[model samples]
Target: MPDLGETYACVPSTERGRGILISGDPKSDTILYTNGRSVLMLDLNNPLNVSVYGEHAYPATVARYSPNGEWIASADASGTVRIWGARNDHVLKKEFKVLSGRIDDLQWSPDGMRIVASGDGKGKSFVRAFMWDSGTNVGEFDGHSRRVLSCAFKPTRPFRIVTCGEDFLVNFYEGPPFKFKLSHRDHSNFVNCVRFSPDGSKFISVSSDKKGIVYDGKTGEKIGELSSDDGHKGSIYAVSWSPDSKQVLTVSADKSAKVWEIENSNGKLKKTLTCPGSGGLDDMLVGCLWQNDHLVTVSLGGTISIFSASDLDKAPLQLSGHMKNVTSLVVLKSNPRFILSSSYDGLIVKWIQGIGYGGKLQRKENSQIKCLAAVEEEIVTSGFDNKIWRVSLHGDQCGDANSVDVGSQPKDLSLAILSPELALVTTDSGIVMLHGTKVVSTINVGFAVTASAIAPDGSEAIIGGQDGKLHVYSVQGDSLVEELVLEKHQGAISVIRYSPDFSMFATGDVNREAIVWDRVSREVKLKNMLYHTARINCLAWSPSSTMVATGSLDTCVIIYEIDKPASSRITIKGAHLGGVYGLAFTDDSTVVSSGEDACIRVWRLTPQ
Candidate 1:
């Protein structure tokens, strides 16, 4: 038998979001789900590869395997539910509208004969059990005054069902006719999840009130309430019983997961696992599941941390990919071994060094990164969500990304090595020179800047803005001496990069052009319309500065030579199935790009 942890295709929660649940078929060794717009069937035993489920109009919220393990049912924020066969050769079995609001959860009957329950958002919540074979409604259970959160049906004979919602009621129903039996209002807050034990002896309910309760399987009567004196500190989001029913595991917003011993006189907590909370906005624990003997926890920042009940010292494994839109990427200059990425939802992932490129990913603090710049052994990231973060790369145990408040939203950043004595950072509001953590000087740019870059020598810096012009500022003494406004692009400049020797610099614009300028004269040496079909997302200069690479919204990567015409550049079409969003050039011959496809592709360039 495969370990239950092996069946999760994708874990969506982030460090601050919630605890993660690893759900799928251990029998098939497959975790069926979706990543972004594509559905995927991942082989948990061998996670390096996966099968794609193509594209959807919106991002997927939940995916589950049918009881017979023949089909997968998935729902999205658009309230669209799709049923597709599990086999790669199978086709779409059904596609239908479930609600006008976001679908929170969906479940199929144990026999795979029908999809018993589905729910949507807010006051529009509806519980309708439908026949799968005929695609017809069988029964409707209604009474909740708020959004339905979770629903489940009994696995065995009695055919009883239960649902919990924002109305703070756990409603019970009996029969194939499915009538409301009773509504329990013991919880003070929203009920998030409900599930029955595998043997149908008991059912577990978790709520935002920070409590987990056990109920009798035969009747809806409460058996016992589990409290934080047992180890949890915040609202519990999810709960699952051990396969043998000996223990119950609950994930909480307090940044911990607790395991409770059921046979004890008071239902004692056997162990408590404290998850390292991400500073900034990434502190929520959202989802969790007990898979086989291991406890799998997920957070809002998209970190999947796996722990063993037997060994409490450390997590055995951690998995990470995408939980939201990837916004920025930076490759280490000295070592092409690692890549740093920032997501729109405020997750920073370090794709570490390794062979076959299957290196591990380390998620940093849970805050949206606005800009990132690497200096020597430290990587500094600024967030519009507030706080400037500094992360060290000197330790064996990956150092946590630590943040400090700079009292303003940093819109852009650039690093310059000024005579081995100073380093500077340019922001939307001002220019700041740093000596370690202390700010030595500040120059107000007086405009909302969007892009910035430092010359190779670090003596000069340029800031671009919504004003459609570039401001060249020369660092002198402790302040900016003066500013020169250069030729403006038709649209705002999005990114800027300098040549290795500081002799030249390039700025990428929203108008799909990359303008290269001479360092001393500030003369426009070249103007290349690299992305004719779409906006240029990013641009990277090769190590020698002889070649430049640009990624665009057209899902293509174009390599341009300084000496060649823009029409004669080398273009790799479909560099990413979706539009390329980030680009990094490793040395003079290699380039890497990450796209909306959630993949980073490496390409080798040769001078022609």
Candidate 2:
């Protein structure tokens, strides 16, 4: 096995609609957030640099750092909580089944010795508190008739607990052996979140009723509600208190995050950070956290916007990335600085180096984007919805997207390197040739088309079928004329690619075999490139056309050189946590891979 050196990684973004808890370490400049089955630790200073902990077997719901910042408590949809080391190397210390259903939120006590896990527990209690190490019961969280949504532990002495839930109630608990004290019904609708002030003097609760109510932290008594005359026009999803406990911030589905100053019992509006857009679904603010001097809020589209607490009038620095599995990746030949990626969900992001998102293509009904190709000044994308989209590459129209129905789902898309206006698409029923988003020709190749490739000169095309055959065709004006059908593969062909210089081509199949073939002779150049244990999902050819790389379902990447066709292959085991689905070479020594984990990693290869 060869050592895999990683140069950069872009982790998955927070999911939409859900109010994910963002926990910041009190002792460091790191924040913890959950996505799918992984817990991610992101550095605040360099947001792109992230460390992933992929131990959770179920969809992770919430994660929190201990007060001492030595350990982290993370929970999943299965209601299991795992305490692990706070260091980049996540070593599990202990595990406990705290609830029967999903755990929506987690909170650690000020001393870092106890935790409260709360959410919907089908037949059991909605909230539970226990010692961090021993898992011994420390308190009882009772009296909520519905699922709990949020929980908070007071940061000072005479520890107190506050929780809000779908039942429209706020429950308070007290003591080392904490017991339920009382419940406050101040909101008209479901309570969405609850948080204690840093000073432990007061707490605030926000709800679907579009109201924010303050309460005495110790006695569970109601204080005056925050002035709502000019407040949120939509449900308030999250609330965070300032470090000094004198102010609070609330984010709402109305596309706004507002900061308020607390004056005795009432809060007055101070500043507003409105989401920039047309106030659509993607602009809805879902989660927020006030850690140190940063005011962070996550949108329904999974963009994390950070603002300076002391200067809310300034435009926020937004972090944008994918929150779902990336299905396709293509670099713009006209502008290498922009890399375009499409995901399982209909998100098309144009990434610029160092910056998160240079721009984004308008989403198409939230369908799955299956394949992507760069054609001239436009981006062509095929989707699970059997539709093709064309997007502009420059100026103010960069995000505008126009679509056309292809009648059947497309499996793959390939661009003709020299012919900028030509592209080839493989569909379930047949092969479709496009001249810049316009269907030039459609050929029912008499078999199930699984993969395809087009020649750089647009003079020929190759279609791979499930029957282990490659049908070669000559491009004639607006149609494909069959040249010959080669039968060499033993399994369904999964991917096909022509070398950049058009000297040779490579094909991978479901049987995990990669074969390099001579273009002119149509003979096998390397037939024994078989090291993968699972189906090959993607393949990329080096710029010099001397080496080929293949990514497989076994979560490994193999680089095979044409010179040493038999013995000198380099292997990168576990290149992606999940199976790798997309692979591309930026140059001769750099490759980028994206996978089921929704993370895109750049690897620096030193092939010996």
Top of the candidates by TM-score:
2
For residues 458-544, what per-residue lDDT tens digits would candidate 1 score against the true structure? 666788877668888776667775568887587788778888767888888777778888888888777755554777778888878
**lDDT of residue 228 for candidate 1:** 54
TM-score of 2: 0.94
lDDT score at residue 295, model 2, on the 0-100 scale:
90
lDDT of model 2, residue 147: 92
lDDT of 2 at 133: 91
Native-to-model Cα distance after best TM-score fit, residue 13 in candidate 1, in Å: 3.8
Provide the TM-score for each candidate, comma-separated: 0.75, 0.94
When summed lDDT is taken over every stretch of 10 residues in candidate 2, the lowest stretch is 3-12
Off by more than 4 A, model 2: 1-18, 363-368, 399-404, 565-567
Candidate 2 lDDT score at position 395 = 43
Per-residue C-alpha lDDT of model 2 across residues 1-608, encoded as one tens digit per residue: 44333423343345454566677874677888877887888777677667778788898888988888888899999999999998857889999999999998989999999999899989579999999999999877779888999999988889988899988999999987889999988788878889999899999999989999999887879986888877999889899999999999999988899999989869899988886665788888888889888898888777778888978887888777677777677766566555677787877776665554665676535567788877557777788888887776664145567776777888888878787678788888898888776888888888888999999998888899898898889999988999988888889999999998898989999989889989999998988888899999999888789889999999888888887864678887777777888887767886767777777766677757
